[model samples]
Target: MNERPRGIESVLVVGTGLIGTSVALALREHGVTVKLTDQSPGAVRVACELGAGDEWEPGGDRVDLAVIAVPPQFVADWLLDLQKTEAARFYTDVASVKALPIEQARRLGCDLSAYVAGHPLAGRERSGPGAARADVFLGRPWAYCPGRETSPRAVAAVLSLIELCGGNAVKVDPVAHDEAVALISHAPHVAASAVAARLVGASDTALGLAGPGVRDVTRVAGGDPDLWTVILSGNARPVAEVLEAVATDLAAAAAALRAVSVDDDGAIARVTELLRRGNAGRSRIPGKHGGPARAYAVVQVLVGDRPGELARLFQVAQDAGVNIEDVRLEHAPGLPLGAAELSVQPESAEVLAEALRSHGWHVP
Candidate 1:
């Protein structure tokens, strides 16, 4: 097996929750030794049992990098204590926001020179080690904030770690990082929650009639409330600013909708234009960071739930030189067949569909 670079032999990951465990797993995949720890001893044990890192060891050993993946509120204090030990030569954090931690670190007299702040713009609704995936960060954009006191070596080490996890790193100032995340991540969470909150008391009949659009809009609302509360609190100012803008736009939309009357064709057109602008604005968001926006020619196909059906479909696609960008499986009761939503490049969709159909699979 390949080994980590000789100079950086050991990595200590503080907080073995979903993000931390996933970082350990990804680092280990590249043959790096990792030590995992969390406030709760049981949580640390769970991470080790899940093979996220090596068994915990007491005392400070010479280590190259320490990745702090705890909640934003706890990062500064943890980094303060970790910096006192020889356990780490340099430190980096995966907190969602940056400015607050930098300020807190300064207050704690932590050595910002050996610390770099990083945020990976990738996550899932699930929490803890069980939900961690080695490839969770693959192809995702990781933002790095190098404070004024940050050292060259510290920046380089964190950049290397980002690349090692199969991510692209972009440098941004701490304030900029907070503002950007407020617009893209934090505001969206609040919006999703707001939408989902509206449905809390809806009748079963109303919910049963909901479609994919509603499902997609409210998906992030199912995320861990405890985790989100910490994140939202840490970046409350920027988040509130963004939400205020959203409120203004929502008010205008409501006004336009309320203006619908027999003599209000102009108001109706205004509402339509507002909706169009929303669509256009959303389309501007990058689909996947590394690659171009995937132009998916979605193909629905019928396959059995039994083993090998998926393998056969994948094999057929591979043989046809069709790279499947994404896949979704749906099943209905009383039917032996399930529908697979295959997202392939538009150019290969027709040929791939034909190939699967020729293999005795039902293609739509």
Candidate 2:
């Protein structure tokens, strides 16, 4: 097949951690040749074993694209080092924070025409190659920032790379990218960590009462602290600004709750307004396929924590010609039972519920 202008046929993936290995795996899925390298030999070996790609060696032919999947602080320097060796015809990075890295690249006199900074807004709370999945970036927004010096060739190459990984390319300014992610990703992680930290010395009773709400709120707190530290430090100002707003709201809520001890009607109004604002903010989040926010009907089923139980639930839904749009599980701690909250179209909810009930399954 004839390729487009310097289309990405082969790629060199640096840093075989979660993002790098995931990108390599995704490219391999699309029949793109991938070469892997990392600071840790063991890490790269694991990635290769996981079918991400083959190991890289010096003096090999320069690839069409190089993905520098290191941290934000190290991305620019790594780009400079790789460019000195002509690692690829075009280059990009998977560092979440963009402005600082682009600035560093300029300060180092790197060839900006060959580089585009990118970040895929997708990841698990876990880290390392073991946590990498080829589908991690599927349907996710891949943000790209090409500076004034960036060549059209570089932008085209990275766009192909994002498409190969099942991502939608979104062009953004470097500083704006940092600010946006600060509001959405970085600051939320810090807030999650703060809430999770409060659970450190809780009593067993309090812990037992913990449910999916707490888990969902604190889920991202499980991310690698050292890595998050680098990302937050790179976009300190924007993240700090977001955190300040969050703190103000939280402090207000606390004060309003304390005032309710005196049977204050104004305090109740204040708390209610905060909750209403939260509902508004949540509703603004994009739903499936980047469409308008939708409200799906939920069908809850008691699930057995054993093999094939969840599959059986899906089978029932399928037999009823119902599609499951989303799912959330609430496990009964120390028990072998849980609730599988299936989200489907409002029209499909009763059909699925009836199917499950007829199949000797408890649908609640």
Candidate 3:
């Protein structure tokens, strides 16, 4: 937080699903008066019970801002209705697909002057208010796409909301936002689902050999299918375009693999070239603070699968004055031991490793 943000002391959060409830909870943490509502009264009650906000009524007083967190298809209609009633001075939506919503708003003849479309590039596999967390948006990119008719005041208020929620606001055009998300978020989620779909009725013997890599690759596939179906449908064309490109690459890789059996001279090169391109693409993903990835030295330590093991290891690193930049845990099946991979600065790696070794931890 570079500066203290000030805007929208009171907010009406429409749709108390995961994103809405999370935004409400985040706003609540910043002392904003959050009034929550959803189509389902039970959802609103759950969010309110979680201290996200108070249950909003139909004819409540106009608030400084209103956040519509409904699915993409309904965002325009919600914006239209809210603006018609002057429910808030300014409004924004958290739907991931931006272009369609903005276009739909235009088609519906809604007032866009006070509305900005936004999408926070952060979420959990779980949906609903019970899965919402105040810190979910911390350090994540919150994109706001202002239409041609949007007012500067509305944009500023949206930026303030993003800041208050501990997110970095990224200003982008609506169509460009859709394309970018389609490539990164939407396409990848569908790809993950496709991969996970292969596991249906898979043998236990095959699944037993799985490791962290498979889990990481298929993690997003666990998201709600109905919700994702709506998301994929909203951004269909862009997502389809990206998926087509991916399918082409995958088809080529498979062909190259098949060629290997016939002893084709170029088969290995073809597959290797695809792998190299994948490495290049993976490296291009932004790291901390939307910057280039930094090389951190990983210190691996074998630990007993017991309570307080990770805490003790972290405490050791703290006492050694070595800040662990990141951490990943590895579980050993059918064994009471696992490995903790601690990422630290190159200079501190040896110090942290030595500290753990001194604490009777196996640094293998």
Cα deviation of 75 in candidate 2 (Å)? 0.5
Candidate 1 off by > 4 Å: 1-7, 261-263, 288-364
Clashing pairs in 3: none
TM-score of 2: 0.79
Please report how far candidate 3 places residue 59 from its true position, in Å.
2.3
Per-model TM-score on C-alpha atoms? 0.79, 0.79, 0.80
Q: Candidate 1 residues 73-119, lDDT tens each?
A: 88999898887765688999999999999899999999999999999
Q: Which lDDT value does model 3 have at 102?
A: 91
Q: Could you give candidate 3's per-residue lDDT for residues 118-141 as a string of tens digits? A: 999877777888878675675467
Residue 189's C-alpha lDDT in candidate 1?
Answer: 94
TM-score for predicted model 3 compared with the true structure: 0.80
**Model 2 steric clash total:** 0
RMSD (Cα, Å) for all candidates, in order, is 6.0, 6.7, 6.6
Ranking by lDDT: 2, 3, 1
Reference-based lDDT, each prediction:
0.82, 0.86, 0.85
Q: lDDT: which candidate is best?
A: 2
In Å, residue 224's CA in model 3 sits off its true spot by 0.8
Clashes of each: 0, 0, 0
